[model samples]
Target: MRVLFFSNPLVAHLLPQFPLARALRGQGHTVAFSTAEVMAPWLAPEGFELLLSGPSAEEVTDEVARRTGADILFSPTSQLVGAYFAGARVDLSLDEALAAARYWEPDLILHEHLDFVGPLVAAVLKLPSAAVATDPALEPDVTEALTAAARTRCLERGLELPSRVPSGRWLLDLCPPSLERRGALSPRERIALRPEPHEGPAGPTRARRAPVGDRPRVLVGLPHAAGATAGLGPVLRSLGTLDVDLVATTPGDPGEGPGLEPGRVELLPFTPAAELLENVSAVVHHGGSGSTFAAAARGIPAVVVPGSEAQQRQAEPLAAAGAGLVLPPGRQDPASVTTAVGRLLADPGFTVAAHRVRDEIAAMPSAVQVAEWLVASVSARRGR
Candidate 1:
């Protein structure tokens, strides 16, 4: 079977799909990724074919501003977020996406939750598409808004809109039981798939991790999205005061951030979360699902300083589950973050909760199993 993983230009959304891609490829199925040209460098290391379509996030944001005068990053509402992804993104990306999909002739299109272009391609081709749900689409109202915006874009493209959000078809859920939002999907339509942290290079193992230092190693990774940087500099400075060695991520020059003595803080660019999580005691991140799940999967407690509502959404459930702590903008400070990390390192309960989540994730269907299910589901649906 041939599978095409589809998303807009967001790396976080696309990251969850990689495990399944690995599974399918291992089983001798063809796999490719479809997105803008900007994502080529990101996915190149994975060695998947890039169908390459659509505009960069900046271009989409620009189009949204020109069309609706809405700045999605600054003040994001459901309607504007819908416009950013479903409205402007669809309008700008549909033609190229259609061309790209036509050339690839994929047997199935697995799209990220917020992406509409893939389903549109499926609709145009009369093919089956399922959602690789990264985040829980908890709000039916927000889904409706996305559907409405997609409807406008579809009409403009002389195509029909999908009947329900996600096209209300098969949903491959990555969320665990405790962190799942209320009323996200019907049991009949939702398929549980285990979530794994994005793996990077084969680095040190748990046994090999002793060389760094006897002191606890804490990872401080904020999301790379625009406006998702909150308390990164201050949090780093505070953590430096503690007895823990730090691992922080930087998209640009590692030399550009807050200065700490050499070997005190390690700044990495594009190191896999799996590699970084190894031997780490706890995590401090922007509460992105990518980071939260990575830490939880390894039973590492976390301190979440959210930079966006989406990040905040991930933080709330984690704190509720006792796996982590949340520091909103009002409460986020050098001292608060330091105390949270310190508490996480010292508290046994948090480790217990983190282990609970890890076990729960382990109990979910593995990516290989889900890949089989995806192929069977699509094959049956298409009568192939």
Candidate 2:
């Protein structure tokens, strides 16, 4: 099988798919990736064929805006309304995907559910594709809410109402049903893959964790997407007052940001996220699907700060599992960030729940099993 994937750029976005990619490669399927050029260096070592989809976040955003006349800012809410209209400028991304497909001629397209172009691209090419959600889409209510929100965004963008919306062939819900109230899957969908384990170096064990003390070690992840940064000065100053050591995952040049001095905060680029989760007592992240899941997989409690609706929706399951705390931007303050971090470290129940959920995620079938399932699902559908 020749499989192609379309996803957004960011280390976390690519991490969950690694295990599946490796699994497919191990099964002798030719796998190709179409993502930001920035991700190519990191993904090259993993042995999958790479295709650069778009040049910069702005270029992609501009193209999406030009193609659909949808304001980029409205993407957060517009993504749910319908498939024809997009919230973000996706023109270049859509073009790149079509261009890649022309040469790759994939047997199937496995896509991130929110990419917006995957289903359309698949339809145009007459190929079968499945929606692999890094978060929960099993809840019809959530999907409906997204649809309505998206519709509102389109109306604001001056785009016409979409006459048709392409339905996905299958929905790959990454979350376990236990955490969701409406977790049941349709006969068309299959729950096959769980979050894959960190294949990178195992940093340390729970027994090796730093003793609870005044300077609690905290891991902070800022999503690499445009406009995703929140002012960290206030948070850093607050944590400084608390005598905490901060390790922030900002790619390169730690001293570039305010209050992030050499000894106090380490600014490192692209350390495998799984490896970073090992030493930290708590996490402060942008609530991206992969980052949230990575922290949950290790049983490490987190503070999820979401600026977008997709991120807002992604935080729900972790909140439900009692594995992490969600703090939206309008609600964020130095006091809130500090309080959330402090509480996550002090609460024993949170840790226990996080660990239990991690175990559940770990127990899901290996990536090999998931790849096989994806292929089988596509083949069976074609036969019928």
Candidate 3:
């Protein structure tokens, strides 16, 4: 079978689909990507056939900002979601994406949750499509907003909208039920896949074996999308005061910051959080879905300093699950960050909860298993 995958140009958005894509390829299906030109380089290294759908991510972001008159980085979740769907600039790539879809004529369309173009093309072509979750907490809202936007766009183009919003057939859920937003969407089918930890282009280079020492090891990682490393310095200084050994992946140059205590904090360039999690006892991060799930998959507790409303939402469920703690909004300073890390380290319950969540994730079906199901589902539909 041939599958067409669509995603926004952002690296974070694209990484979630990799495991499944790889699995499908291994199963002897052809998989191609439809995304912005900016993503082409990243896709080239992975050997996937890339069909250009739009301009660079930077151009699209700027376009969205120009159309909405809001900094997407700082905008509220609702505003960002609404703007992303309704903004004229966001749709600039749709015409090309549709043309690519028509040319490829894929048997299946699987897209990252935020890329509405997948569903729109699927509806127009009367092809099967599924929405793959990137951020579990945001999928419902994304589905609603994208569905409404797609419906309007379809009508304007003199086409009928699909019965469902983003997906004509299924919602491919990678997150465990416990972590996802309750009743986010009423999909015709929900396919559960184990959340495999994969670090795409930016993953760690050499696997450093677990830090060999008596002192507990803690990892501090900032999300690339966060775009600023200013907050990391203070947090690093605070973690420096603790007795634990600290390893941090700085957003920018690690040398710009004030010197941390020699053995207490070690700052390095961006490495995959999953790589670092293998050696760490606890994590302090910006609470992106990838980081949060990576930490959980390894049974590592986290202290989440949410950088946005969506991150805040992701953090809340992790904190509630007892796997981590969320630093209150505006309390992401040195003192608060230090205190949360201290709590996670000192408390045994957090470790216990982390392990439980890990076990839950481990119990889910692997990506290969999900690939089999996907193929069977498609074949069954064809037979009918």
Candidate 4:
């Protein structure tokens, strides 16, 4: 079977779908990607054929901002969602994606849940599709908003919106059961898959860092996006005071700050957090789904400093599960970060809880299993 994977122009959105795609390819199926040109550099090295679609991420963001009269780069969840799908961002890509789908003639499309064009293309082609959730905070309200926007687009294009506009034939849940979204009955079939770590192409091999010593090692992973580093200086200063070796992953320089010890802190450009989690005792991050699940898979506790309401929503469940702590919005000062890291380091309960979640993640079906299931399901549907 030929499988096509679709995602928004963001690395975070694309990474979660790779493991399953790889597994499908291992089973002798053809796998290709449909995304914007900006992602071509990252996808080409993975050996997947690319069918480029849509405008660059910058163009999309600028258009959304212009239409919604709000800067989409830093907008809140509701505003960003409204501006992205309700605006012409999704529509801009729809035609290219549909053209690619028709040419590729994929039997199935596995799409990140947030990318609306994938489902629309699948519906138009009458092909089965699966919505892969990259984050844990897939609220019903958000789904409804995206669905409504997609329906309007469908009507405008003279295409009929499938009964399942937001969700596809399957909803791929990667979140641990404890962190899964509640309070909504999804209209599609829910299939749980273990969250596998797949960071973009590792540039080049470097000498591995020395193994952890007596001091605890912590990873601070702030988003690479512009302005995501705001207020991060204070957090780093707070973390420096503790007797721990710190490794921070940033896109550019993480300028020097008050308490930063050069010898104890190492700043590198965009290494996969999953690779770093193996040697770390805990993680402090912006609570992206990739970062959260990477730490969870390694049984590392985290201090989630969310930059948006959507991130905060995802972080709350980890705190509730005892695997992490959520640094309150207005209180993300140096003092608060210090206290949270201290708790994660000094308490045994957090470690125990993290290990439990790790075990649960391990128990979930592997990518190969999910790949087989997909093939079987598609065969059954065709037989019917």
Question: CA RMSD for every model?
Answer: 2.8, 5.8, 2.5, 2.3
The per-prediction tally of clashing pairs is 0, 11, 0, 0
Model 4 accuracy (lDDT, Cα): 0.81
Best model number under TM-score: 4
Q: What is candidate 1's lDDT per residue for 44-112, written digit by digit as tens?
A: 877888988889998998888888887877777788878888888887788898898898898888898
Candidate number with greatest lDDT: 1
**For every model shown, what is its TM-score relative to the native structure?**
0.91, 0.75, 0.91, 0.93
Q: How does model 1 score by TM-score?
A: 0.91
Better of 1 and 3 by lDDT: 1
Each prediction's whole-model lDDT (CA): 0.81, 0.66, 0.79, 0.81
Between prediction 1 and prediction 2, the one with superior TM-score is 1
Task: Look at candidate 1 and tell me the lDDT of residue 191.
Answer: 89
Which parts of model 4 have CA positions greater than 4 angstroms off?
77-80, 139-141, 162-165, 184-187, 199-204, 227-231, 253-262
- Of candidate 2, the 10-residue stretch with the lowest lDDT total is 80-89
lDDT of 3 by residue, 97-129 (tens): 888888888999999877777777887788888
Model 3, residue 38: displacement in angstroms? 1.2
The C-alpha local distance difference test score for the whole of candidate 3 amounts to 0.79
**Model 2 local distance difference test score:** 0.66
